[model samples]
Target: MTDEPNEIDGDLYEHHHIVVDAGQDLLRIDKFLMDRLPNVTRNKVQAGIKDGFVKVNGAEVKPNYKVHPMDEISVMLPEPPRDEELVPEDIPLDIVLEDDHLLIVNKPAGMVVHPAYQNWSGTLVNALAFHFQNLPEMKGNDGRPGLVHRIDKDTSGLLVIAKTERAMNGLAKQFFDHSIERTYYALVWGVPEEPSGTVYVNVGRSLKDRRVTMAFPDGDFGKHAVTHFELIEDLRYVSLLKCNLETGRTHQIRAHMRWIGHPLFNDTTYGGSEIVKGTVFTKYKQFVQNCFKMMPRQALHAKTLGFIHPVTKKKIFADSELPEDFSSVLEKWRHYIDHTD
Candidate 1:
């Protein structure tokens, strides 16, 4: 019997536990814990112990303390309430599916997921607040509500929002375990050399530019991220690809694809805005510029999402068609391919 203190925002909260087996050998508490937690650093565990957040048999214990069988361990940490309010807005939503516990939305490009600096209104959260009056209480970052996961503002597609605490925790766990199935469609600048492959690298915030992420191939920096991609259509100078995310980090698909030499079409943040392919003839340049004008954002969409139902344990899946801008751009590319040769 064991109760562990929950780790939240680098602070300990709700209780957790692990019962030692009868034949278990003595092990240091920190090392023992490091083996159990996923994606947690050893230094983090040691820090938790050093801060007296871990205890054995109702007594605070040191990191190096040896653990024996049947020791009841517990940690106590209180979670302070978040202090912010969401002002409901009347923005419209393109909801695809809704249940008593969850709602699936087909978010359009250019819509911010939640309120942020200079984006305090006209956000998805604001729209949701006005639509659902009986939302469950959640201490979200800066009072954002119901968001279990999110896609980038300019990259539109499907999103699943939790309506209750049970659903939120359930979906959050699925994301943490990387069990949620998500597929994205991207129109990139160049065709991948391989038909299908995976990019395994460390992705974290860029040191040179805080606004974007960078990949660390040698595992020297950042969090572990994996993206699997397959070519769907070859537009010669460009290609349409499907990307499956094994780990969802900020800009995982965008940054990883850029690292592999095929930045998403028109992704200005990673240098996709300028022409990277095709002829330099004035007519050709005008054609390319016209395409850019039609679709100004990155050509990436969250095409599909699948997860187990929080209430029924049944599988739930949602798919989204490309928005008009994305589809129109593809049609232009198809026409270009058909006639250019």
Candidate 2:
């Protein structure tokens, strides 16, 4: 409904001190903040907690900390400079579906979802700010307009935007409930052992590198994540997969796929950039390299999204075609297998 909260750079962004209700039940502080913070995502709140920016009753608390009755919660974060504020840019958008209440856009790969510390311009948020005026503002959202969720910068997909606060609430609830239907097409290395199966793991920020997420199979840390994968095509050394997310944690599909020994194709972050399968011959390596050049980023696409309309109270479903790089690369694989075999 409103703009996304500003990035935490240096200046004080926000300072909130709230006293828990006497009847408050034991709820994770992260979840507590989700309901209290204006336009802030769970990941942001978790980051604050992880970075010691969040405290309970004057004591630093982890994300999983429980908020008890009469407890005091404080969150103070550094704000980006005034110049760091969002700047609308004139960027082309592939809008898939649009209505008075909401719209679904097919986001191309290589576009950041919103402005952050380094990427302050040329983001989807900036485009929305430019093309529309007076998008419903959610008090202290900082400024993403109506965006609620986001995909990775290099992962192309269908994303929904709300036009009103009512729509925002409705959509947010659907996401929280895992009732939103989202399916992704991921080109991964290695055919899975099973033609189709589900991967259940706990995914969280790597204690080693906070920027990237990883899987914690022990379930002691991180959030519960589930990704149901069905093998769609087998390309010998590689495979095409249809991944249905049961819980949408950060990089859930990527993390799960990597942990399951099938990292996405061309996903340098998760180690798929190398020739995970196929011969170690120079020519085979060159072929994989050529494929990587064909699709420079992770070979993943958000193919479908379905949810209940916020205002219309009806089911809305939309599907997106694979982008050029994805389709072309897949075609190349098809051709390679057809001829090389």
Candidate 3:
């Protein structure tokens, strides 16, 4: 029971409960939620209010409802409206592990995890639709079949998909509890001041620029996010980092690293596309441009994922080798660093 909202923790939202303070002033429920739930727009709260996902003392409330002291409030964020049915595609999936209850897919970069606006086709969900016959049996959060969690379209990684309802609930609880082990490899533009450290910060959507995420160092806004980072290699202008997520906030790694002035290399959204380091020589600029072309995306990959098997009650751990694009660019950086002064 709390008012804290994880604004961008993957696509899963938590059910929240709260009790009004003893001496609270009367305030609009929507505004109150907006203040408590950082990075959420007023309209979104109002929408949830309209959808009857928000209740006070077990009764649905209107957007204009005022809060009173001792009132018990509960809220559940609803999924966005789906305009079309998911269509299965013949896209090949690199399944790493599979059992009766669950399967782990090594998702490649550039593949959307589920159907959404502008990416309504050729998603991992679409492939799941094609591969499974018992579609009705695999429903998960937001009707995304078998999906317990997701990574970004450009962030390649391991994903565990539940094949049964029991599996789904079990895995979802692990994610909610933050017990699932997840680690990523990222090439950032600069080295951190520490070889290993944790970025304990709040990440939420920017108030001024809504398209990207911003860090709240003072915890003044957004959801709590923690990314543990260790410098795996220092390549002069760029560095290879191993990032372990303690809390899976939306853009946690990208935003947190950038906050400390080391955004993921070639991450255009986080201002990593430009050369943040290196000399202002024409040759250096050209070399970086070539590396960007070689990778053609952010230098981030989900390298390892581990969790307890939902039904088997056994531990599951999966690791993946770096993709060609990611490894090749690393080679380029390594060579360049060895050759340069």
Clashing pairs in 2: 2-138, 3-143, 3-144, 3-145, 4-143, 4-144, 11-79
lDDT by residue for model 3 over 1-341, one digit each (tens)? Answer: 44345442345343677888899999999878876654567778899899878889878899999999999987766343334567878999999998888889999999999887578898999999899755333332454788878899999989988887889888888998999999999999988889999999999978766557899999999999999999999998999999999898888899999999999999999999999999999999999999999998898999999999878889999999999999999999999989988
**Tens digits of lDDT, candidate 1, 1-341:** 22334455366564556667778789998777765543345677788778776777767788899889887665445563222358899988999899999999999999999876567678999999999976654443336678888899999999998899899888888998999999999999989889999999999977555468999998998999999999999999889999999999999999999999999999999878888877878987888788899999999999999999988999999998999999999999999889975
lDDT of 2: 0.86
Compute the lDDT for candidate 3: 0.86
Please write out the lDDT profile of model 2 over residues 187-243, one tens digit for every residue: 999999999999989999786566678999999889999999999999998999999
TM-score of each: 0.75, 0.78, 0.77
Better structure of 2 and 3 per TM-score: 2
Error of 2 at 321 (Å): 1.0
| Candidate 1, superposed: residue stretches over 4 Å from native | 1-84, 137-142
Residue 210, candidate 1: how far off, in angstroms?
1.1
Candidate 3 residue-wise lDDT at 15: 60
Clashes (candidate 2): 7
